[model samples]
Target: MAKESSHAVHAAGAHRVVVIVDENSNPFELGCATEIFGLRRPETGRDLYDFRLCSPEPRTLMRDGFFTLTGVAGLEAADAADTLIVPNRPDTDVPRRPAVLDAVRRAHARGARLVGFCSGAFTLAEAGVLDGRRATAHWQWADSFRARFPSVHLESDVLFVDDGDILTAAGSTAALDLGLHMVRRDYGAEIANSVSRRLVFAAHRDGGQRQFVERPMPDLPDESLAPVLAWAQERLDSPLTVSDLAARAAVSPATLHRRFRAQLGTTPLTWLTGERLALACRLIERGESRFEVVARRSGIGTAANLRTLMRRETGISPSAYKARFGPQTNG
Candidate 1:
């Protein structure tokens, strides 16, 4: 608890959300906040967030050479917000203004959640909010972040890390995942899924940043594993093993392992598990009611197994997840 008195709470029905913007703020990160929380969505019957784009001073904020945003709120707006979002800051080397840092500290102290996307994580770290807290940012900046804030427990491999109140996400599109997660937390998985579907994106992503990273091309150009992967994806309900995959790929088990390590940066089994989890999550989002059915379709085969796996990956039971993501028919 830091300073609870300064933050603003939404009126009984509205969700007060604020995004801090500055000169040279990346429009995409700011847009991620606005698009998810600020956009007007009437179909879901969810109370929209009372969104504000704020700055430390009253002035025009220029970005991307052509777009100029003016008449924005001041730092005090962030201090008063129920949720404060810090989008990407232009320069990590620039010292955070004392006023901005104060606002962040006060908001978090009062139990308001704080979020930083991409370089915004640096700002949270500068404010001392991320000290001893596990967080992440763009992998490219991982070294500098560690050097600048040695006390922070930075994990760069994951797309995002949700540690209850304060959360941080990696670079770029990962912000979408982080924002969707916030929606899932605040409202439920149902709202999050609806929002994602509106955006025409997957409700849940597989693996983490590790999957997106570019690696040196493998020495062998093996189109062999592609067919096996496609086949396995079609029959997720069927139990599959490395030997089965290897046989389908027409490669020795050792070769399959090496190929997977070289091309996917993970073992075939791990990749399969991630795919199954993704499938289960999608089914949950689509309003599937039966845990056993979801388990079977996702290849977990049993509700018990599905619950164990979902808990391990998301820290929530399948029923709880469905409650969050399923249709809001009753309401």
Candidate 2:
């Protein structure tokens, strides 16, 4: 989805993503969607999603009347979306528009992807679409959401919950995390990396991570793993172990594990494996046909191991991924 968007960005082959904004809606989360899906990315020099914004009324007063937004698309635009983002509001108690709720229900019935950023989860729940599905919202709204929709499984502590087609984010910053995650799902790790770099943001934060830090963070530079992470990324094809990373960071393996848990919300082995798998994906999407070559080049050990890991992580075989995202060739 590559398009220069002022209000409506158009790209013929890109996935269409539309955001619905309503009265008292928070513009920050709306802007997060625009930045991730709407804006043209100069990083990969391609657009990842064809994006648009819509409102139920001509002039909707934003959260606290911070601004009155106008001149965007109408609520009917929700019907055309490959993915529909419900209105995100700060005042969780304020009732969502029936039009918005109906749009969400229609989108759900049609199997279009649905997203709820921050308190937008309430909108989805009220629409009756989030029932029996795992979701999350701003932690502060957790109690209220559960009390209102006891049928919906609400996990408030995580950054976001990805329950297949329907997803929800925890807070405003988590909105960015979920957006980049969606980009990663639609495109690939490489494109998502480029976009994250352009945004100057962390590339990946697993959705299972806590919304708030549980422990005191150690100061960077004095005992930072950035240098070691950089070193390992450059040499992923090498036979490196947790001990190797620990040694490079000038810390014991136990200490390194603790830091990875506290700082990155993941273990060292998982992070390393994900990086290697991402490298394999990049190689395959770039036209590497030999599975053995991809495995060796990505330090995934062997072709069988590569296939196993690929299926476990991405739920697709390398060949299937190539067929979906690979460069096209004409006969």
Candidate 3:
């Protein structure tokens, strides 16, 4: 999935964000939509989004009988939105209301950006918006998702997939990550960081962090790859090659490659680079100002190499990154 460019900032007040709520929806996912987009942020010094909630049945929608949501707008509201977010459904197999599916399809047909939180991807898939496009959902539903929608590229690993106009988050918790990503694309890093500070979370988590949630942590002690992964993480500053990783795991490079792909859905090198980048972010957040120092400490080797890698991975320069997430910003 292609990320929307951060360099092209949209004008303030131009974006309309609509949340589609229904029976059996997850309230936490709905709250994620509202908290990220509905709330007004004066700190941004510009309007972020005109946000509202809509329902196929406008009066009230009960989420699993745990609570009730009232005062939601009707389906017509989606037609006016620049973006439409579909939160998780109670059961992936249960078909959505015909009107609900129609609203989603119409919104997409009219050029509105579509987003699915967790099992909400099932809704989009049922509506035919996700056909032949890369998407994701709650990891628990991966097999059923593939069985039902074979045409959709189900990337079970990763927090979210940003397939340009249509985006799908892996799980409900990852919804915030995807939302902040949208904010960054619409406004810029500085504004997105401000929002993250308010929320007490990182401004961004690379989408590549997606992994199979079921076995994210190794269960078997002796036979587990966790020890080997921990060993490599502790020594990212060293020139650790595939052979080195294989040796640490006491397996051949070929076996290690298969294990990494089977367990993590990513190559060993890609995972290592993500870890190194994460370390680089921490150094930047800690007020590390020297690019050379940051590079050596993060194990990217040199300042020039760090700059190139950081930009390619994050779509922002290191200095600009520091400006938003550095320790000074915390104060």
Candidate 4:
């Protein structure tokens, strides 16, 4: 069994993110990592992370032999990573290389934050790092993962799980969700929003969302949450409710709930709250020091409500948030 980690990651400098590529690794997930962590952000005018790709071998073949990736860093790169993404491949049954597992163990022993995407949970489990930690993997592999690693708490329904030092994404697309979430944790909500806009993806999706919906396909081409979401986003400062969102979508509240579940894998109220909270954070980031002002402007109702919600969501008070993200004033 792996030891529990209370100590933070033994990393320094510009937070480095390293992805370990193994044979038969899925390219989509690798792309998601690079897009979120490695891409140069001309919009932000600064590289957010020191992202690197490493492999146990010099030449690594991707999932289904789609392409060969060569000439990146070696597995030793994982040691220097503040956050290390363990190798994930489609072939869950095939055992991970001993060297790869050793690297994972070494990283974990040193308190490096470890991430597992899709079937990568299996790798982390095999390395004995996720023994008692909660994690999520592709729903299809939930039973297998649980059966193989009985001690690990596997939350199959969730899109991902962020158990402090260890994180895991449920499926291929969920990788992006988890990646954006990581950016939010590292850089804050504002930068995460910028990255999401660049990808043209939804800015925030709660990790508790279902991994897969039974009827994921839209019933009609025109049936979309975009218009209603847009309407609600513009009116976040208003006393907006789920019913209001339903009316804007021209659907019954029940139908709205179904659509929200089908499309976003979240409830109407949850989405509304998230949007409002995001607005509140942005207001604070832009130097809204008074909690009362931020609360009213962001439609969060009151300063006390803002404090409770902010603490619940971000684990910090409005003053603390302002101190971290707000404009620095020299005394």
The TM-score leader among the candidates is: 4
Tens-place lDDT per residue, model 1, 16-95, is: 89998877778888888988999988987756688999988676455655577778887889877888897566577888
Q: In model 2, how large is the Cα lDDT of residue 50?
A: 78
Candidate number with the higher lDDT (1 or 3): 3
Best by lDDT: 4
Q: What is the C-alpha RMSD of each candidate to the true structure, in Å?
A: 4.6, 4.7, 6.0, 2.9
Backbone clash count, each prediction separately? 7, 2, 1, 0
> Which residue runs does candidate 2 get wrong by more than 4 Å?
1-12, 42-47, 214-217, 329-331
Candidate 4 per-residue lDDT over residues 80-121, each given as its tens digit? 888899889878989999999999999988878899999999
- When 3 and 4 are scored with TM-score, the better candidate is 4
Better of 1 and 4 by lDDT: 4
Candidates' lDDT values, in order?
0.77, 0.84, 0.80, 0.86
TM-score (all chains, Cα) for each model: 0.78, 0.89, 0.68, 0.92
TM-score of 3: 0.68
Off by over 4 Å in 3: 1-12, 211-331
A best-first ranking of the candidates according to their lDDT comes to 4, 2, 3, 1
> Using TM-score as the measure, what is the rank order of every candidate, best first?
4, 2, 1, 3
